[model samples]
Target: MAHLHCLPPSVEPRVSEHMPQIIDMIKQIIDSGCAYSIDGDVYFSVDKFSKYGRLSGRKLEDNRAGERVAVDSRKKNPADFALWKSAKEGEPFWGSPWGPGRPGWHIECSAMSATYLGYSFDIHGGGMDLIFPHHENEIAQSCTACENSNVSYWIHNGFVTIDSEKMSKSLGNFFTIRQVVDLYHPLALRLFLIGTHYRSPINYSDVQLEKASDRVFYVYQTLHDCEVLLSLHNNVNRKDSIPPDVKSCINKFNDEVLVSMLDDLHTPVALSALSEPLKIINDLLHTRKGKKQELRIESLAALEKTIKNLLFILGLMPTSYSEVLQQLREKALKRAKLTEDQVLQKIEERTTARMNKEYEKSDAVRKDLAAVGIALMDSPGGTSWRPAVPLAMQEQQVVAV
Candidate 1:
């Protein structure tokens, strides 16, 4: 979670720590006649739970009639699943009324969840695939153990794919977070992850990640520019009243972003809402008309404050934007197999070539720098170099702030 920049859970109840609770719940289910013991093994009767397949919207008969899974002879019904398994050699065991046994996979989740979050939690989330046997069984087991197992909302996120194909180790498409961050910025991957709606299938590709990195860089650059421009002004006090246009934009942000967030965590829509305000901020910063306006400093200040708050709320802001850019630059340098000294040497060569009217050599130097993921932007002030991610799909790849 830390690697992904997510906060630790409020309660970290280990399943092993809650073994007694798990055992009690299993015994309670058995006592309620929802589960049965046979040859030291316990199985939950799906028929006893009338809402067996409710969570998954699956019919019991349809599940039983499925052709793929062969019926276990030990089970009372085809849909019946294990609650506990008898102790096996070279495995850990817990003492139970049904003799030495271990709890099944689904029971541990229900037990820990009920122990910490309680029987009636607000939201229970997992992958969409868990909706079937895993979650369905959890619902049955939890509700059976406690009469008021009111899990208000059950949310499931879609799976991630690699290059539009299902990610599988066997297919040589599996990637670890550490491996990915070693190549690109962790926030780049984070941005790519949240770029789409939670319920939508996200395709992971180098190109998409490059685009996400660019978006992150653009926001940082904008923020840094705002910081510079705002620093030039001595009056840093908050304005009594912002421009009507700025006020309207902020109100719209609350309406579009915060409200959508409340309405089922519509992150994609919330992210999209930022685009307009960010463009407005950039316009105010860059254009002469915006600079000449009376409310220029005030508007920029308001925007800077608002944007930073929004990014923090969304868990998108870095502790230091400069640090993020630095890391990206370091990674880009390594990726290009170039060091700081080597890059400086190349830049000096390029500058000298340009100064001596060696146009061909200067052009070649520019190509060499670009090949190493470095873009040179020559402004009236000076020539500046930054790590450059590919600008393919330029139209689609907007700086979605």
Candidate 2:
């Protein structure tokens, strides 16, 4: 699954591995008089932390009236949170000076992060729901235990909704990443996942996935065509400068895409910025029409390299160009309900009909193939077939009509 998603270093830190450090931090907070113990359990005193609600923007008083928080009279403040939970029968235990108990959920993260990433980190991210008590408590615990320990950015991403409803197992609307990729290419799922701003809620639907799949096909299809053109023009001796418009397109991609990504990880805008460069390349590839001079081979190579680098950064098109195009063609064939052998047979029959001067039969065959979404192109080299509708685009048009 990690390979499929192209994730990097997906390692989980076990709280049990840092039990002593957690116990020490808890002791440090208690000795600082910011926390207290009753019987065997330890709870942090929220009243001691003057900036307690700074992260969540909710005062302790606000939480005091909130129904979601569980109030315990044993704590000094109603907003006080547990740091160490005393062991119960049949429960996991780690020996501490206070008693045999385990670290609380928030404390576990604090201790593990401090032990691994030290007192501070650049970005701390989680779901929007965690902005409240969970993250708020982590900040409170970390600040009290370690000096200058703080997150530079508290990045919280929005949830995925199914047709405007929150997806849940009990609701029976939940879909796993594996299930999603099973139906669509992993890149399509990746594109759908990042199609919106990270902080904005994303709605999941088959239509959206199909559209993303189609976009992926179009992107790779363009890349494949660019590769073919560049292969013919990959000579360094041509030594022609990049055309003005093409250079402008590349500059815009570099400026817009990179700047958007750097500005708070605005990937949606960055992905949208890709369209300008792609359109420019497509126009150039189709013909040198508008320009007085054609673009040199080096210029095409540069454009191809620029786009490939951008796609690499987005974790798309990891395979060789030919391999990706082959996969896309196979997918397109399945969508058109046609196999390679069937397509080949039709092409052969059309060739035979053309050779016999059976123009009507050949034309009829072409029309039939077109109806099934197959496009046949005859060339000096031979005959080749590609799906007439680029999958998603065709489906979208049909729906529109």
Candidate 3:
């Protein structure tokens, strides 16, 4: 079972403190004729509302009789939905005007959101699948209970698919947030999620994740290299101030990208803005001319600040610089433990045995190191060694050792 953390004090919604009042309002609805109580259960009369399907584009008549709609035979119409369900023999229950039973799924959100965010909140959001019975019902419940028209903005994110197929329990393609974070950098995963607009479908694949990882790595590499250069020369001066072309690029990105993000969170456009500073920083670092150390430092600092702020807004910032470095170091040390000079000495001994045509000795040594995590890669630079960890850490580890 997944362990659920209590909502942090900093983030717990302030409006949730009024749950009792919200429940009381729902009780008032039952007292009115609009809602009906049958066998200790309560249901909404959908036919009473004129704008029932505006958000989902679903028609009331088209909704057929089903298990999710109305289970109580006393419901006036199949399209009517439950406000509160009657408790079963051994199910969780809460006391209400209609006896003991839990609130219906849609009713809980309506009550909770109304209790905390007021009669009507600024915005309501969920996955696209919720537009129908879930969101539609919430709207109906809140409007009738509070005598207020519900939210001003309605946002719905798209579904995620794997291997061009819909993710489902039966197909065995469902992935948890923790599972994906274990295999890839969490920031990279966040970037991958934002690579597409929030309202558009996202297809997941190993190739896409690998590409996102590369992009994140590249951005960090540029930032790290720029910091190194700035520290080395404190007096390098900028011959020219911020270039007009660079300024224009920044402005255009802000207008295009920020506008898209503000328009119901167009994450894809926001992600595209990442390229502008990345390109500018790379060019400045590579050119490495016409700038004094102090000026270069200021310029890079400004650019880095901008990128960091934007990334934070997108929820894609690295969790911590120290944590990233520590992980890299630990991975490197594990690699070095298996393949340092000591392991190579054993390999040499086996090679000598092989020269004497003792094939068994050579094979045995290879197997021994393989068991311990040592691996050899033949390259133009001669035989180089790397750990199974990311290649970026290998050089740093070698230097430290």
Candidate 4:
């Protein structure tokens, strides 16, 4: 997680540590009469809150359809949930106004959040499955605890699923972060997660992850190329003017990335915006027409700046492009189950084949290398190689464990 720069929260308070505040919150909910006590157990009454189902859009009736008949019929509604549970024979107990009991699961969030972040806050998030009984009960309890208590926004991210079913251990389909990062880069996983919109379900497959890994390598590769070229010609050419098309591509890419991100965090569209500018940069660096242009260096500089800035906003930029490239290549080599020496040896064989006028043999070697993600670039100087996105044989070639 640190490799991807996802930081920990500033506050990490536990519900047990905040028992006084939790008890105080239960007292408020009870005072509001939004809750009821029975035999020292407290449960929030859904009947008291008319806006109980507002966030989940599950009507009170809709929640009761498939539920098992309530064992404890003392509850007012089937959807009503525990605020505090009376201590059983052998459980840890906290002193509260409702006797020796501990906080229930739902009210712990409400209590802790209200105490720390206050009753009303900006954003709350949870899985879609939590919408019905968990979050609905929270709203019933929290809003009634204090006047004008509310959450401004509730963001629900889609579940990561496999074969159209939610990824689960009992289902025999679950991939952990440690298992995934062994086969692919961490940023690749992060990129794949954001490739789809936040609200849409994204399927998890070896194939999809491979594509994302390739995309990450490509972006890092392009950045490395631009950096090298920009440094190679540090002095900008004043005699030539920047091409209008370069400027336009930069503009469109910038606008699309920002606009798409701002519009409900539509990240997939922002990701698409990367293709045009990347193509232009690569074209300028390698293509014949682009090399002959008067302002090639100027164009590269502009595009690189635009790309680097946008990548920062997307959290896609690595601390060092060269390091990222090297790391990804190492991972690719592992995926292919081939060492660096083996790859170089193949390149040598290909070079010898081409030198001896064995075109078929050379082509065959190139194809084999490509199958393992080694891309050979033929230049006037020599046949150089770079790592491209590896083909999806890693599932078999490399065990994720």
**Alpha-carbon error at 141 in model 3, in Å?**
0.4
TM-score of each: 0.92, 0.85, 0.74, 0.92
Candidate 3, residues 1-401, lDDT tens digits: the string is 12111124423443235436545766866665567888888888888777888888889877777755435568898778888777798887767678877777777777767656777678788998899889988888777776765688888988899866878889898998777755556665666777877788788875565456546656666767776777686575545455565567667766876797777787777777778777877877766562533345556666777777776677656655445533433333443464256766875777687789998987787666544444454445644433242333333312000
Question: How many Å off is the CA of 257 in candidate 1?
Answer: 0.8
RMSD of each: 2.4, 4.1, 7.7, 3.6
Candidate 3 C-alpha error for residue 13, in Å: 8.6
lDDT of 4 at 329: 81
Model 3: CA > 4 A from native = 1-22, 67-71, 232-240, 288-298, 319-401
lDDT of each structure?
Answer: 0.82, 0.77, 0.66, 0.82
lDDT for each residue of candidate 1 in 1-401, tens digit (9 for 90 to 100): 57568888888777767779988999999988999999998899999999888888889877744366677788888788888889999999888888997889899999999888889989899998899989999999999998899899988998789767878788998898888888888887887888787887888777677677767777787888888888888666656687898889988887887787897887777777777777878998888877776688888888878788867777888888778888877877876788878887887888899899999998887787886677777777766778776434444444343
Superposed by TM-score, candidate 4 places the C-alpha of residue 100 at a distance from the truth, in angstroms, of: 1.8
Off by over 4 Å in 2: 1-5, 288-292, 331-401
TM-score of predicted structure 1: 0.92
lDDT of model 2 at residue 21? 86
Lowest summed lDDT across 10 adjacent residues in model 2 is found at: 392-401
lDDT of 4 by residue, 183-300 (tens): 7888888788888888888789877777788788888888798899889776755444588888888888889888998898888888888888889889888888878976888888
- Using TM-score as the measure, name the better of candidate 2 and candidate 3: 2
The TM-score measured for candidate 2 stands at: 0.85
Enumerate residue pairs that collide in model 3. 15-116, 16-116, 235-293, 236-292, 236-293, 237-291, 237-292
